[model samples]
Target: MTAPGGNMPRREALPAEPNPHAQQLAEQLRALKDHGELSMRQLAARTGYSQKSWERYLGGSSLPPRAAVAALARIRGADPVRLLALHEVAAGTWNNSRTSTPAPAPSPSPAEAPESAASPESAASPESAASPESAESDVLVASGTSAAGAGIGPAAGRSLRIALGAGAVALVLAVSSTVLLALRLDAHEDGPAVASPVPAAVTTSAPAPVYTCRIQRVDGLWYAGISRTPDAEVAYGSTGPGVAEAQCLLRRAGISPGGIDGMFGPLTQRAVKALQKRSGLVPDGMVGPLTWKALRG
Candidate 1:
C-alpha cells in the first residue's frame, strides 16, 4: 500500500525551529578571517574603515559599528543576529569601564591579565592548534594555515575526504549485496517451474506351452492305474511296443516320461505320482503298459 501523494509517499513533518548556534557565528567569522590570511585592519580597509576602528572591534575593546559588523558578516557568511549579540557584549563592557569612577588603588595584582594573553608574541599572533577541541581546532587551522603548517590545518579536509571515500565504497558494497540477495530469493521463490511426465512403453508376448511325460519308483514301483487307489493298481515288468509313443503321450498328460528314452527314472516316477494325485488316481509312483496304452489312446 502507498500514501495518497500520487506515486510518492508523504514525508514526515520537520521541527519548525532551526538551531540558534547553527553556524557558531563568532567562531566562523574568526575562522574566515584566519583562512583569508587578513588582519582586522586589512579586512576593514577591504570593506572601507580606519585601522584604529578595526582594532577596537576585533580586539574586543569596543562595539563594532553596524556597517563594520555587516561587512564582517558578509565576509564570514555568518548570521547577523549572532554577530549582533557579540557587538552588544562589547558595547556593554565598554560602557561599564567608562562609567566606573576611580576609587581605590588597593588591587594592583600581577594576575589581573593572563600571562599567555598579555605576552607581545601572543598578542601579535594566535594560540597553538592543540588547545580547545583538537578536532575542530585542527579543522580550522588546516583550512587557514599554509602547506607547511598544514599538519594541524589540513587535518580536517583530509579526514573528510577519507570519510567520503569510505562511505562511497560502503554504499557500493551494500547495493551489490542487496541485489545478489534479491536474485537468490527470487530463484528460491520460483522453485523449478518445468515438469514432464514419463510415458509407459511396455511390450509383452507369450510363448506356446509345451508338454512332457514321466514314470518312476518310490520304495516299490506299481502299475499306473486309472483309479485313485495305488493298492488296487496292477504291476508290470516291461513296457510293451509303442511305449515310446505312449510315454510322449503321457508326457502330454502332465507326467514325466524320462525324455521318452523307453526307460523311467525317479523323476518320471515322481511326475507320475504328482499326476495320480491331481487326477484322483494312486499317488504311488509307477507306470505299467496298461496305463501307458491308455495315456497313448
Candidate 2:
C-alpha cells in the first residue's frame, strides 16, 4: 500500500493515524538506507545534515527541507523524482504552517508535462533546475506529500497522488531487481549436481577357461613350460586358472599383471601375494582356499 506522501495508490493504514504522510516518508528513508547501504550517520555525513536531523526526519517526528531531500537522493544514488516529491511534501507542510489554518478547497488536476520531465537528467552533474532544493520539492509534490498538506489545494493533491503512485512503482521495480539478482546467485551456488549412471554388471559368469597341461620337467618339478616339446609354452605364460585368476584380480585392482603373459613367473607370484594381503588372506603366492576366495570375489 502507498503511504500518504508516496506515489503508490494502495495506501496502507499506519499507527501514525494523525499523519499518514509520516509512515510513507519513513518507508522512503528506509528504502534509501537499504538501497544505498548507508547508516543514518553516514547519510548525514554525505548530505551535510546532522545525524540527529536525519534521525528526526526518518523517525517521522519532523519534516525536513526540500533541499535535504534532494541531498539525500544524491547521496543514495537514487532517482531525483523521489527526493523532489518529498520536497513538495515538506514545502506544503511549511506553507500550511505559516497560515496555521485548515486546508482550502481542492484545485483542478495539473496538465501533463513532457516525458522529459519524468526522465533523469542527461548531464553528469545535476542541472540547476534539478538542484537539491528544486528536486526535493518536486519529490514532495510528486509523492502526494504536498497534497496531504494544506497549502497545495485539493486538485494538486490528486495529481500528486498519481505521480507518487508512479514513483512508488519505479521504486518497487528497482528494489526487486536487487532481490532477483541475489536469488539467481543463490540458485547457481546451491544448484544440484548431475550424477553418472553406474555401469551394468557383465552377465557371463564362467570366464573362457584356460587350458592347463603339465609343463616339461625343469631341473625336477613341472616348471611351467611345454609338456613334450619342452621349447613350446602355454597360450600365454600362465600355468593354470589359479595364476590367471591372480593376474585378472591384479588388473582389476589397477596393478599391471605384465600383459597377462601368465607364466607363474616372479611378477605373477608377487601379484598373487599382493592380492592375498589386500583380501586379508595369508600372503603366500599359492592360490589356496583363502587366496582363491579372494580372487573369485
Candidate 3:
C-alpha cells in the first residue's frame, strides 16, 4: 500500500495548510527518498536518521533537523542547498506559528492582586489549635491520662497497660520457644545435610552466549549471522541478539566488545563509543544505523 511516488506505505496526510513551507519541504524530501528507491527503514539505515523521525518530517507533523535534511539528501545523491533553504523558511514559519498564537493572560501575583480591607478569619485563635484524634497517633500514657478525645480514664488506662504488657511478654516467650524447638529439631535430624546458601548466588546466573565472527558479504552488506538487523537501535543497558551482533562485529573490527557477552554493559558501551569515534561517526556510545553499517564493514 505504498504511495505511487514513495516506498512509504500509504503515507500519512500532512497537517493543515498553515505550514505550507514545511509541508512543501516534507513533500520534496519524500520525493527524494522515493527517487532513491528506498523505504523509510532503508533511508534510516543509509542516512543515520530514525525511521520514525523521517515519518514525522515527511508527514509534516514536525520540522526535521538541518542535519536530517542534509543526511537524506546525501543518501538520495541530491544537493542539500535547496532543501536546506526550504528548511530555513519552514523553520521560520514554524516558529511564527508557535509565537503568533495568543497565550492566556497570567494571573496577578499576590503583591499585585487587589487586597480586601479586612479578613475576619485570617488570624486563628490559640484555642483553634486542635490535637490529632486519629487512633494511630494516639498514645495512652501510664501517668493517669489518655490522649485527648480518647474516652479511657486513669483506672481503665492502667488496666489496658497491664493487658498490653502481659501480651508482649507472652509473644516474646512464644518466639523464644519456637526458636529453641527448631534448633533441637535441626540437631536431631538424621539424613543428608541441607545444601548451603553460599553457592546459591553463584549458581543463579546462566552462562553468557558466545559469538564467533564469520564475516561474509551478503547483498553488498557484511553480516555475521549474530543479527541481520542493520537498523536496530541499541544503547547502554540493551541486551539480546542485537547486542551480541554488535559485539561480534566490533570484535571483527579489532575493537573488543568484552567477551561477546549478550549483556550490553559499560565496557561494551565504551567499546562502541570507541568504534564510533574511529568510524568518523558521532561518538554517542549507541548503536544506530550508521554504527551498524560501520560494524558490518
- What is the C-alpha local distance difference test score of each model? 0.45, 0.53, 0.68
For each candidate, give its TM-score against the true structure: 0.24, 0.28, 0.34
Highest TM-score, which number?
3
lDDT of 3 by residue, 1-297 (tens): 344543565455666858889989998987887676787657765655445456777788867766568778877778989998998899778766744653332233576333311323212322112211111112223322442237654444544543444354346446856997999888768333554555887989888767666678787777778789979999988988898888888887888888776788988999999998998999999999999989877
The TM-score of candidate 1 is 0.24
| Candidate 2 lDDT by residue in tens digits, 1-297 | 323332222222334524555556666866676566666546654665544456656666556555566667777677868666755675455445533544443332444344234634323325434433344445545555545655766555655554554455456446856897999988777664322122223444466545333333344423322122222222224575545545555565665656453457777767767777787887766655555455434
In angstroms, the error of model 2 at 286 is 83
Q: What's the CA error at residue 256 for candidate 2, in Å?
A: 77
Which one is best on lDDT?
Answer: 3
Candidate 3 regions off by >4 Å? 1-205
